[model samples]
Target: MSTAEPQSAFKVKGQGTIYLVGLGHASTHWVHAMMIFLFPYIKQDFSLTYTEVGFLSMIMHISALACNVGSGPLVDMSGRRIIFLMLSLIGTGAALFLFGIAQSFLFICLLVSMVGAANNLWHAPGIAFLSETFPKNRGYVLAVHATGANLGDAASPFVAGFLLLILTWQETSMAMSIPVFVALSIITFSLLPREKNPHASSNSKGMNLRDYGSGLANILRTPAIRNLTLVIAVRGMAQVGVVLFVPLYLVDVMMFSPEGQGTTMMLMQVGGMVASMIAGTMSDRVGRRPVVFAGVTATTVVIVAITFISNDLLFIAGVSVLGFVLFAVRPVMQGWMMDLTPRELGGSATSVMFGVQALFGASVPILGGIVADTWGLIEVFYMLAAFMLIANVLMFTLRGEDAEARA
Candidate 1:
């Protein structure tokens, strides 16, 4: 009986929980990517400048940074992962629905701030759950989790484009919120295993306020953790710059229609979906540093080359290649951080990782907006390339063994 019970739990842990979490992850990203898809419409409908549109993202990230800091302690202290996860979906859906009806720029800023703060509720708990469940295959499992995000990222733009053809952006947003609140929330509650005893969980026992503070401080003080966190933040700047400006470039400079922009963005995310699987599995075998080095190096080269390309098809292909290498490294970075920190501190570590990411990443959109207003949209890619180079240098300075050795 004992043997059977362990085996049954293992099976569900291996298959069922991961699927539920991945689906929830996808749904969370659907809200995020959809907002990005609406940028062109928002800019036009409101007669907003580049700086104004960028402020929306800046507000989002700043709110996210604040939530991320608090979420870690909440996850660790409460041991209520599902509650946090559910709130993430519900909050995002509600915000998007309200945003669709919002009439003023100030109201829009408030909605995006809500989106940013709510959206981060998913990551700290989600990452801690997955990392704990799939300890042996951290890289591969996190990659699978990331692939769900790629799906949401890939499909939202295309779906948003199609809906925009038929419905107003307002109507489309209201419609998009339906599945998240109705379907994804149901799945999350139905399939994810309940925490029978939060007090009994290993993560919470004997963990007090002073201990969490001292532990978090110790974790942050480590050279490897600090270096990895900086690398993520710097690389995030490149990513934020690209995601914020690329759609605008597609609309304004390239003169692409909504459908064309969607297709290009879809292709980029599809490449990420494929490369995520490959990079995550490879990092498990070869090591995280090599994968990080190769991926960032390729990302820099592609972003630089993209500036010179004028042909529409070639430009799309270049962006696709950029997505392949750029996102492929993300799961590896997560796995590397998990390897460096203790298992019990997973939530705090994930929070610290994302907090710094949000902190540094918040600056990119506004900075890119200034650069675009001053020079041109294309110049933003040059700035992204510089950020990527700095990320590569930071990654190189870190001294570590392969994740397997550390584990």
Candidate 2:
């Protein structure tokens, strides 16, 4: 709404809210990233095939997709962003704890489904909250939020891996779940006092179902939203695919020790942390498309280079570069989508964005599994590179950011 306004015109509000939300975001990601370390062990314990592992990933995405579709409206109408965030933290921790005690593959799948749904529930409220709090600095603020994720992602694998050295995979998962319950509890409960405390007030009280449908249709019809969603879906597919398989690749082909694997994963997140800050701030001033285009392009190149790399040190370095390029664009994509949609519909818009990502990304792991099964783990990186290239082409079909702002 204030696209033409000067950058200095609006002073940022909810400064504490931003950091608190960021901390909450970190805990959510830490819960998710810890699974990467667990996957190798899960695979070994179950004697699962690659396809089965991929199927587990698919379950996670599908569950997330289902939750994402509904969460937006719930957050928008209920005006209980912090409540949903707290619920998400609790659900993820419960799932992780129960996962450690899981006795059967079916039970594990069920727990994974719970994790997927609960993890995604955080995004609608989290993104909508920050976007509303700092509309002008959406890109920068969201990037700072993303930096929390980078820290969590960076820390979890190493922690999980280190724990794995002393404890069983089951024990590591159970142990890690405790902190999520503890640390995030303090942050979320502290916010309860300061939150708008809407107590389930409906923002769209007068809008009927038909009105909501029309609003959604209009939003979807925008070529920019559709194109960005598709590009993001592809990127999500690559990201989820890589996350699902990379640990297995490190374990199976590279023969990396648990600590070595953890450290490498940590490096990738460190690169991502740096990039999210720079790219997020840069996108705020320069517009979203340039930052997204450059990052996605570089990501494609880095992913391609990763496939050819066999040397341990070189491959680890390449992964860090991949993280810098690949992760930088995520918040930019969210900011760009926010710029295009109505502010009131921010929750629904975030759902649409993330839901589409989950829908398409749901297939990535299974597909990547087939590719890995047919060729090798290294070949999955090739698949990811191709997906990025397709996304880059999709980027060009989008209207320029200035046009998006005007819309």
Candidate 3:
């Protein structure tokens, strides 16, 4: 009998592939956490209206959305993992450095947009890599990858919040650059192997650009994708509302100090981290539909509860539950999307899901701000709760066998 040689060190399988993807996703989580930490400082420094702040955030999300659409096919065709990874690191690091020194709102917005674009470059390729690497266990692997992001989200805010006490916002921004640079160095030197041309693979079925247009058209025509899109859109609106406004609510409505608000937010991240891991693992064993439906329903309940509570401890409890529900379903949803997509259109399908979510998230803060300005912050929470509940109903309608078969 002939013996085959062992695969290379970078040839990850099972848990290791999940870890690799998780590490890449951690960079995304850190950026999100850092942005939350900087929001208060930016608002104070720029003397900006809530609408203006929303617009700046919108620029970042919109830029990310655009990049995801543009980069999807290239990533699918090239299979240049190391190249995309290195570029993301460099671009994000440079943008962070520029952001630290930005003097005006426009400069800040521009830098943030660049950072968002960089992040977009990182995401699609990384996700596709994980999906392909662990085809049999896509949900489990993808969930673990997402868990890495939750870990970063859980930690970064606490670090950023603590740093803010000792440093200026610019210095805090500068500090955020170090991680991406380190991640890039690791990927360049050790973590990622040289990629084979995607066209060379036996699995390759070249995706024409025109096919992407058709794939999107097909996506729109499918009732499942359509409903899922609406569910995610509503969820995205609620997510933005909470992330952008929670601190403000803690400060103005609940009468908390900055430190207190930061601490509470940190707790939310902790809850989110735990929830992401648990939900991902559980969904692998139980099935995607149950996990997602339960999470969304729980999240809606938590959001509604928050509007009626004023005590700090109670509010933190609600936020913790909110965090759990908000993050727990993420992996299941992403897995569902992958399962729904044809193998040939993996990159394009994932990009469409992300694009829709980004567009929805981008619109929410502005709409929420308008509601807050016209009605009240409490009213914003009510709207967010309603959105979540509606999402829950939509998610419940998904066909389990259909989702599984597609995967």
What TM-scores do the predictions have? 0.94, 0.94, 0.89
Best by TM-score: 2
For model 3, what is the C-alpha lDDT against the true structure?
Answer: 0.72
Give the alpha carbon lDDT tens digit for every residue of 185-205 in model 3. 776665455354332321344
Which pairs clash (backbone N, Cα, C closer than 3 Å) in model 3? none
lDDT score for candidate 2 against the true structure: 0.84
Over the stretch 243-313, how does candidate 2's per-residue lDDT look in tens digits? 78888999999999999999989899999999998988788887888899999999999988888888999
What stretches of model 3 exceed 4 Å from their correct place?
A: 1-14, 197-220, 254-259, 404-406
On a 0 to 100 scale, what is the lDDT of residue 67 in model 2?
A: 97
TM-score of 3: 0.89
**lDDT scores of the candidates, listed in order:** 0.83, 0.84, 0.72
Q: Comparing 1 and 3 by lDDT, which wins?
A: 1
Candidate with the larger lDDT of 2 and 3: 2
For candidate 2, the C-alpha RMSD (Å) to the true structure equals: 2.5
